[model samples]
Target: MSDAARRTVLGAIRHHLREARSAGDELPAVREAGRGPPPRIGEREDLVREFATRLGAVGGVAWRVAGIDGAADCVASIAAELGATRIALSDAPLVRALRGRLPASATLVEVADRDAIASCELGITSAQAAIAETGTLVLDAGMERHRLASLLPRVHVALVPVELLVADLDAAFAAYATREVPAAITLVTGPSRTADIELTLVVGVHGPQALHVVLIDGA
Candidate 1:
């Protein structure tokens, strides 16, 4: 790409846009015209099951538990399996409630403690919303320390209530639109992954090696 070629392309794009606007066509109209029909999700489909399947397909684990106690037990079992000595926890109320139920073997550390976060083996936080279609967990920055708690650890655990689950991204977006936007929003589908030029797949290179999501009922 030469500079001249780049300028030509940009100029062409501007001309096209101007022409469309002069013809009473707007950007939204163009976008709507180009968009395809939304995906059809069966009304009877179990969102939890759909989310679990999609998460599994992306190399993440998902569990549906009966209540907070069940969620605690699941987290404790995972911590035991990983032999995590230090766990980082975000400031979300749902995550805080699990503090009393955590295993004694692992010490809980605040996500804001930079030194402690560096040594933490696992992170536990709460997700604001989850998309069943893609098995994505939506984390809002409004919840203090969730970003570091989720990202800077070997293992990440997300405790999501059943009511927060949505059928697709459209529904998730609509839900967010009803409230004030956060400073940042992160959508995580699975553990971090990257591939080389040879198409070789690698996992956990950029973020947590393992991701565990527990969906709690009767929140």
Candidate 2:
């Protein structure tokens, strides 16, 4: 671009800023802070229900359970639905309960070889938090095992406590503001899908074919 064109663009931007300031539209604090309040999504909607609706719209499944016991029941039902006789498992307490409820023939592989995990029909782990606004589950992969189990299987099942549900992404991050940063963090809003080619939606293109979240009441 020519020098004259660059100056014209700068002049237009400065003029706009001046007009905005004069109209009292300039929020210096928020601008300096580099962030502001997120858009309100749960103002009139029930958060839990909203989360489920959003999740379903994205081709993911969600179930709200009474508590941990209900979660175990839901896990069993999901296992039957998927015809999964073997599953990769995590060590979280919520995950453990699901493991215990599996049938005698169903095996839970806690310490798995990569090939075994990839071959399993499903994988189960617990979410660090669930965002109601976008139906996203936040996973802190501080323990390396959870990362592999959540990703290697054909289906990824997440058990999240009701108390861990937050109204928005900001609230979710605020809950862990004081915690030490993990080696990795994953935010999953739905099942792995892509529509990049000819706008044809394909599930399980890069990750699990299915993503299920069972929300339990007890935290």
Candidate 3:
């Protein structure tokens, strides 16, 4: 879309918001009037288990490791299992540790080009946060920055810190409320999949077919 078009749409949204507020047409729900309070995950809930279980339910794989070292090992094993000869990686501190760890025949790559990303069978990146309730990986998106690596490969490996896990979207947004607005936030729930064809299910239609998450607690 053109900049003018974008601005027009944004202006319309702003006008709509102003009109709504002026009209006071929307009702605010209050817990005092019998409505229950918003739901939240238990404070003592095991986030690791919850995240992993929820991920599996949506066709994503998750592994809990002790720290970055264990996560590196897990990524190597997973790559080997899939017979991956080339793996694309983001320049994340933790993911970069796997550079020299893959099998001698396999290569670990970190580049921003499409051709470079396409050559790799697996892609590795890090998440800003992981939502335990819905098993989502949230990334701070930029214009095609790290998009090719994650979206072009057959398999995607995401390294996320366990401490960054949130109970739900509400909690996720709350954490960012005090921070400056991000350019965009990408929420990945599972492997790229769509069944828009003649009812035949398809995977990797627009992104990676397999999603693997490595959660590091000690990082």
Candidate 4:
């Protein structure tokens, strides 16, 4: 672009920054700090296990894996255990690895339409990241094509990379900010749940009835 155009863009950005900073916001001290919950840092194995535990606590099942092959095995096993005859698996490498290997007893569909997957009993995909505090799985549109790939099916299986596990929401936000724009970003916590009627709890009223989180490590 021309220098004039560049200057015009920069001027607008600077103006916006000036307006934001001049809003009389409280400036932080040089070393501002607060006492909050301690960060839950752990090794890959420990973190993956904790992630599985949280997913389970929120009415979702979780599996642990050492690598891609193990992940593939877990996927096949889950499909079999659930008695899912038709399943939709995402385009992620982890899901792709299970393509031909899944039991022939079930029909494994790849890159199928979300609505088609909705008709099936299972759907699997990889997550962009997962928030531990809220037990949320972050699904970036770019990685999974559409958020509904994980949401609209009866049973959803999510493959979460151990390295992408963040301790809390703040960390999740930071991780999201660094990524390119996606068609959508979904933060899913457990199955679709609501306490709408007289504070009574209900499940599978809105989204998938079951969520399976497979936390993959060292891959």
Candidate 5:
């Protein structure tokens, strides 16, 4: 509130930054030491199973399809079931592949059109990476315009290549650390949900009511 208080806060931040720089290469090691042992989730199929299980537990649906065509078919089936006429799609290559495969009744809306995306019944996007331990889908803004598409629709569909699946949050962060960090990284585990003080749970209060994850096995 006061100028003196602001100066004190800034001074503390500067001192912390100086100490952090002094740690140099040892900083990563220190940070790692503070975290306990990572979870022992198994490899390949096991990871997929775990991800699906966790996602379902949180009110999300998961499907493992054979290829891109299978993914398209799955999307079409969902669109038919929901009677979705307008679908918001991201600009990602994988997501674009489903353009012609959707049902004739459904129309594709580009993610760039914010107004259309807001009114769409379904949103389709590609996941940069997925965490098996928590069943989280990582959407990178640097990769495409996926934020609004994933958030503004009644149902959200994410196409994730099998290769991008990671064992845990640690592995996901490690993968991100290899490159320049994106401006925004969204970790979505399930549909939006909230509860009142009496603990009466409600879904789709702020975002999509349903989340569907289609993991392409050999894409």
Candidate 6:
């Protein structure tokens, strides 16, 4: 077509698109079905266990630890039992403490390189908080640094400080909004699972196949 004709056609198309977009009806009102149940708060230890249990119910496992040494021991045992020799770790102080404790045979990963993650057997990191009601683990990505490292591996381990546990999603959201921009925030509920095809349950299809939560009592 001639240049002037093409311009006229494009202009008409753009106008039509704008009109169609503006013609959409308003969305329906959203209302809570009922007043929600009272929010439940737990002691740090209990919150950790609750998070662990929730993950476990969805096929993930969790462990509670007393301190640094305990965290190392926990990782070592899991690596040994699961025959995992490679692990990815966030560049955080508490996780760095695990350096001395990891088995020499176990290789440590610090960055979030995709190949490095795929080669590794496990990924380990820390989180910003744990939401009990939704069984979610929150990660302030920039704050945590290696957020991708935690999500991109086959097996993932987290060293959760007890004080980071919150009652529910709302509280978690409030905490996040008031805090500094975390770079990236991830709310991981369980091992990645999907039933997209023929209603078949598949685990690790979208993300890590296994999630191991290490809720440290006093880190």
Q: If scored against the real structure, what TM-score would every candidate get?
A: 0.82, 0.78, 0.79, 0.75, 0.85, 0.78
Ranking by TM-score: 5, 1, 3, 2, 6, 4
Please give, for residues 1-219, the per-residue lDDT of candidate 2 as tens digits. 699999999999989998999998955554554656763545423888888988999999999888877888888888888888889998786787765687657777887588877778889999888888888999988744578788888899999887777788887776566987788889998888888999999999868989999988764
Residue-wise C-alpha lDDT for candidate 6, range 1-219, written one tens digit per residue: 699999999999979877876899454556866435545666766776677778788887777788887888998888787787787888888888888677788888777677887788888888888887667889887676766777777888888887888988877877645677755788898899999999999998868898888888778
Candidate 4: worst 10 consecutive residues by lDDT?
29-38
* Segments of candidate 2 deviating more than 4 angstroms: 1-34, 38-45
**26-143: candidate 4 lDDT, tens digit per residue:** 5565655653555555566565566667777889887778898888889888888989898887788767777787778887767557667777788888988887766789888876
Q: What is candidate 1's lDDT per residue for 1-219, written digit by digit as tens?
A: 699999999999999999999999857544554534554454424888898999999999998888888998999899988998999999988888888788798899974977788689999999998899999999989755698889989899999998888888877776665788889999999999988758788888869999999999886
Report how far off residue 7 is in candidate 3 (Å): 12
Off by over 4 Å in 5: 1-6, 12-41
- Residue by residue across 39-158, what tens digits does model 3's lDDT show? 466553487778888999879999888887798789889988999988888876777777787767887777777898899999988888888889998887642255667788899999
Model 1 TM-score, 2 decimals: 0.82
Ranking by lDDT: 5, 1, 2, 3, 6, 4
Question: Which structure among the candidates has the greatest lDDT?
Answer: 5
When 1 and 3 are scored with lDDT, the better candidate is 1
Candidate 3: residue 25 lDDT (0-100): 77
Predicted structure 5: lDDT: 0.91
- Reference-based lDDT, residue 44, model 5: 88
Question: Candidate 1 — worst ten consecutive residues by lDDT sum?
Answer: 35-44
Question: Residue 217 deviation, candidate 6, in Å?
Answer: 1.1
Question: Model 1 residue 69 lDDT?
Answer: 89
The segments of candidate 1 whose C-alpha lies over 4 angstroms from its true place after superposition are 1-45
Lowest lDDT 10-residue stretch of candidate 2: 36-45
Runs in model 6 deviating more than 4 A are 1-41
